[model samples]
Target: MHIGKAIRMERIFNRDTERAIIVPLDHGTTVGPIAGLIDMRETLSHIAEGGANAVLMHKGLVPCGHRRSGPDIGLIVHLSASTTLSPFPNAKTLTGTVEDAIKLGADAVSVHVNIGDETERDMLRDLGRTASRAADWGMPVLAMVYARGPKIKDEYDPAVVAHCARVGMELGADVVKVPYTGDPETFARVTEGVCVPVVIAGGPKLDSVAGLLTMVRDSLAAGGRGLSIGRNIFQAARPYQLVRALRGIVHEGWSVEQALEGLEG
Candidate 1:
């Protein structure tokens, strides 16, 4: 790895702990105009001020004029996409390259891979190629690996989830964002098998803040490296407060109840 890339990776890993608080704004690429994310600029500002360590977005969101106000949050340019208009949602194609990400001043680059989907093989190939390029450039690659396909009867199955995590590590991903398997014990096994950091994805918006906090706590207990939450935070009644509550759980190790109370106060 180049000295510069190594330093950037170190920064993303968090100086205080191995965990990270990543606010993902790349949803617009897939779902298009998600309710709370209609204004990318406002969302990015809230995330940065709320003490998130990093923010992941497409290149357009980070263009100089758009993100003018915010503390220096680590930036990870999402390099893959499958727009809502796409005929096949699972068939994600590369929209940007590591070189482009570097030119955009990205601290790292991210790609998504649907492990059990029909397009799995092609996506895995993309992951390998991207990882190789990132490695050569010394840039870290965050792989979003989710299980979905005829072969995947249950995404929450411990064995299947663990396999997904391991596949990301095997393919050279520096960090793997995966869905939590509903319990810490199962997730523990998943994290144990992977050498790289494993972070939990906050899937579709949760029913309530309490529910989201509980999931965050469970993931941390299961040895996850913090979170890569999107809708759950941004769509909340108080996005800034929600992030503070999540930060309490992830960084301070506060219990779900305590985190909620802190937010309410």
Candidate 2:
């Protein structure tokens, strides 16, 4: 990694533990202004105050999401998008450039690609090009790879999830985000042989915090990096509280029981 890249990555991945808790606010682009996102500035403050390691968002939202004073968090610009209303919502296309993210003072850039989507080829090409550009600019790339297509019966299958992670690394992602495979043993298979950091996506907001925390704990136990969770943090009854709990689990290695009882309280 370039010296500049390493320095920037440290801002997101703690220099001490090298684990990260990223709260992504890029949902507005795809899902419109949902609850907890209508006021981007307020939400950003909550996320920052919670001691999150970074915030992932679209380039346009940065001007409004930045904090004037508070704990510092790394900024990552999401470069790929597609509205939820699209016929094929999984067919993500690159909408921004790595250079644009760099100019925006971003520590990294991210792209979404679906391995089984009909447009997979196009998305892969875009990911490849984006990674190449990011490498030159010393910017980290987070490839949000998933398996969603007619052929894929179970996107959450451990085997399919593992393939998604591998594809991200093959395409040159610094970090890879995919759905959790539901159990630690299955997830261990997902992370095995993957040298780069592999973070699990929060996916849709769940009905329970314990479930989310349990998944985080199991993922860590299985050798997963940390988390790039969004809604599970931002949409909770206590947003910052949930983030603090996540921090405990991801960085401090707190057990789910301990995380909920202490930090999440």
Candidate 3:
């Protein structure tokens, strides 16, 4: 690893735990200022207070979310995007570059690629190009890859998810994020097959906090590096407490039961 990339990786992944609790705050670009995201500074403050390792957002949001006064946190600039209003919403296009992230003082750069989507080839190309550029600058690349197309009956299938993760590694991502397969056994397969650190993506919001906690715990048990969750952490009734509880699990090795107990306390 390049010295610069290694240094940035430490910023995103806790030096002691070698894991991360990343909150993606770039949704405003895709879904239009949704709840929990309307106030970037406040939300970022809460996340930082809760001890999250890093936060991912688009280039435009850097000014708003990266505040002057707060506990420092890592910044990952997302390089790909497609609005929900677009006719081909699943087709993520490169809207920024690794150079853009460097100019913005980002610790890392991320790209989203939806496999099996009609524009999968283009997204893969973008990811490959971004990874190459990031390497030149010694910046880490986080790849959010998912199976979300007509042939995909289930995005969470262990086989499909593993394939998505492998694609990210093959293309040169330092970290890969994918939807968690329902259980640890299945999810382990996804993690075991990949060389890069694997993190779980928080898909849709769930009804029960315990359910979410359990999923996080299970992923950890299955050898996941950590989480790159957004809505579940940011949209929670208490985002700060939720992230603190997650830290206990991700960094402190708290079980789901222990995490829930801490969350309620």
Candidate achieving the largest lDDT:
3
Q: What TM-score fits each model?
A: 0.95, 0.97, 0.98
Badly placed stretches (over 4 Å) of model 2 are: none
Instruction: Please give, for residues 121-215, the per-residue lDDT of candidate 1 as tens digits.
Output: 89999999999999888899999998888788898888988998999999989899999999888899999999888989998778878988888
Could you tell which candidate, 2 or 3, scores higher by TM-score? Answer: 3
Off by over 4 Å in 1: none
* Candidate 3 displacement at residue 92 in angstroms: 0.5
TM-score of candidate 1 relative to the true fold: 0.95
> Relative to the unseen true structure, what is the C-alpha lDDT of residue 135 in candidate 1, on a scale of 0 to 100?
89
Residue 72's lDDT within candidate 2 is 77
Residue-by-residue lDDT tens digits, candidate 3, 32-97: 989998888999999999999999999999998878897999999999999999999999999998
| Candidate numbers, best lDDT first, in rank order | 3, 2, 1
Better of 1 and 3 by TM-score: 3
- Candidate 3 lDDT score at position 226: 96
* Residue pair clashes in candidate 2: none
Q: Model 1 clash pairs?
A: none
Q: For residues 60-166, could you state the per-residue lDDT of candidate 2 as single tens digits?
A: 99998777887878999999999999988989988899888988899999999988889999999999999998899889999999999989999999999999999
